[model samples]
Target: MNFKNFGSQKYLLSEKMSGFSSLAHCFTTREGGFSTGKIQGLNLGFRVGDTPEDVTKNYRQVCDDMGFSFDNMVLSRQEHTDNIRIVTEEDKGKGLTKESDIFETDGLITNLKNVPLGIFYADCVPVLLYDREKQVIGAIHSGWRGTVMGISAKAVEIFKEKFGSEVKDIVCAIGPCIGPCCFEVQEDVAQHFDSEYVLKKENGRFNIDLWKANVDILASAGVPRENIDIAEECTKCKNQIYYSYRAHGKEHTGRMCAFIELKD
Candidate 1:
């Protein structure tokens, strides 16, 4: 991950995706925004008790820093399902300047230039996809439910079906989220994952590796392993730099955004 800052606001760009000049992407950190009090610093989530005005200001700062207009950015509602929406020129400003018509979508994809796809997360894995050859991009919010449902892998298929993109031409970046180190689950939740990715502890609890689980899903879908980049930062472990729903509780925690746009 490439750490960058514009004034007090800090963000990250994936090492693999940053090499391309055809796209602009950012994974925002919880720093430098108009938000204050309980949910301080770059709180992009409008539903998390933050004012729409403050959230818009936060989005504007990030859009300006990335050299794209916030008006052209499109965001998902993210209901923890595997639903991925293929955005177009008409979808621009859907969840921002305009009232959102999108419903229960966990992912957003687009081939349109200057139309940035955005997804918000606290600890849920945020996956950004780019088809360098086809000029297509995707942003997915893969929480444990979405992961088990194979949203990341489904995204690879979306690239092929929607934009004539080859699996080999698509690259993915899995951003920071709650890691196995702190993500303890019970038998009900642990039963959903493959045993190869689960660690059963002596206390009868389990630790599931969401990062590796997502990697396997993408690779299984034929996205080249070498084309994937994992941030490997655990939001729970590094709560100072990012928000963690488990650490701060959902009501008090803010969300970080994974946003991408095909350069116009």
Candidate 2:
């Protein structure tokens, strides 16, 4: 991942995805927006108790920085399920300029041009998928629950089923999230993953590596290892740059937006 500065706004771009000329993707940081106080900086989440007006301005700021119109963005209403929605041009501006028609969708896929798929995150993993051959793109919000449900693999299935996208033609980028170094979980959470991905720490706690788990899931779904890029950024460790729900709590933390679009 590489840092990109557009005036006061800062975002991360995947080096692998940057080679594609027909795509626009970014993982935003907590910088350059109209939000204030606890939700200061770029708070892109509408349901996180931030003022709707502030969020609207934040969207405009990020859109301006990314050179895309806020009106063409479709935001996900994440429910941590493996549910995937295939968006179209008609779904543009949902959950942004208007109320979202889609709900309980943790992942979104689209072959539509110029309609950006947006997913909010603080600590959860952000996975972006693009099929060069099919001109399809996807954005996923995978928390531990979503990862356990194999939402990343589900997106790959959608790409294949809906657009005839071959797994070999797809490129994936896993963005920043709560890393295994800081994501300690109880037995219930740890039970779903394999022992190889879980680190048994002291006091019956386990550190679950969502990054590697998702990578394995994608690989199982047929995406090549050489085509995947893991940002390896821990939200808890870098709480100052990215929001960390564990570090700052829900009341004090704001959400970042991981967005991707298939250019016209």
Candidate 3:
């Protein structure tokens, strides 16, 4: 992930998809915001204990840096499930008002211009989808459970099933998250994934590779391997630039958002 420094706010972008003009997307970091202490900067998760005013300020800062209206964002209340919502103009500002109580999905997609879709994640994987030929975009929150359920692949499937988008025409960016280096797992969880990529040990513990598993899932669903850009940054190991619920124990931590929208 390439850190984009735009004076007041800093965010991350994929180098591979930098040339896609119609796609406006970003993976926000824990920098350049008004909050203090645990929720230091750019925390988008309202349920993370940050004051509503501070959360609003953080949202505005990120949107201002990206040149998108904060009011146009459709935020999803991620449940770590495979539920993916198809967002429209009517869903705008769902997270900022009464509609905020209505979002129950872990993923969001839209073909509408100026309507940004956002998914919040701390240590969970953030996936961005863009269908160049169909002008469709999707944002997904895939944690270990979601990955086990193949939510990344399911998001692509939902896009194609609903919008008639070709999986080959979609470019995916797997944003920064808890990398395998720090994402140690138990044997029970390891049993849920394919052993081809997961490494088992004599101690009965496992070093599960969630990234490869999701990539494989996407490929199986027809997304080319070369079209996926995986961010090398690991959230658990790089807590200075990210908030890790696992690394931080039960401490109140902020969230990073993966946002995408079709440019008008």
Candidate 4:
């Protein structure tokens, strides 16, 4: 992943996906926007107690910086489910200019040109997938629950079943989130994942490696290991740059946006 600053706005772009000229994608940071107070600066989530006007301005700022149309974006409701929404032209502007018709959807895939798929995240992992050959793109929000449910792998299946996308041809970029060093979980949460992905610390706490878990899940689902790029930056650790729900607490931290759109 590469950090880019456009004017005052900053975001992360996948180096793997950057080579594709027909696609535009970005993982937004908590920098550069019209928001203020606890949800200050680039808080893209409307439901996060940010002013609606400020949230809309944030979207516009990101769209202008990333060269994507805010009017052509489809935002995810993101209820931590493995549900994948196959986006089309009809879904454009939903959750932005209009009320979102999509619900309980944590993953979004689309082949439609110029229509951006947007997903919100703070500490939760943001997974971006693109099939260069099929001209299809997907953005997924995988919280621990969604990760255990294999939402990234489910996105691979949707690509194949819906767009005839081959796993080998798909490149995935796992964006910044809470890493193993900080994501200490309870026994109940740790039990859902395999032992290999969880580490028991000296303090009687278990740390879950969500990054490795999601990568393994995607690989097991048939995406080539070489084709995946993990950002490796821990959101909790780098709370100043990215939003970290764990570090800043739910009430204070703002939500970031992960976006992908196929070029027209």
> Considering summed lDDT, which 10 consecutive residues are worst modelled in model 2?
63-72
lDDT of 1 by residue, 1-264 (tens): 878899999888888999788889989889788898888999989899999889989988888888876787787788999999999778989888878889899999999988888999999999999999999999999999999999998988989987899999989999989998988999999999999879999999999999999999999999999999999989999988898998899777998999998886
Which clashing pairs does model 2 show?
Answer: none
Candidate 1, superposed: residue stretches over 4 Å from native: none
Candidate 4's TM-score: 0.98
Candidate 2 regions with alpha-carbon error over 4 angstroms: none
Candidate 3 C-alpha lDDT tens digits along 1-264: 689987756688987567777878899988778887767787887887888999888888888888666777888777878888888767887886436754559888888998888888888899998998999988988899999888888888888888899988989999989887777788778888788757877777888777787778788989999898999678889987888887775455898898887887
Residue lDDT tens for model 4, 67-149? 89888889968888999999977898898877888999999999999999998999899999999999999999999999999
My TM-score estimates for the predictions, one after another, are 0.98, 0.98, 0.95, 0.98
lDDT at 26 for candidate 4? 90
lDDT of each: 0.90, 0.90, 0.83, 0.91
Give per-candidate clash totals: 0, 0, 0, 0
Instruction: Quote model 3's TM-score.
Output: 0.95
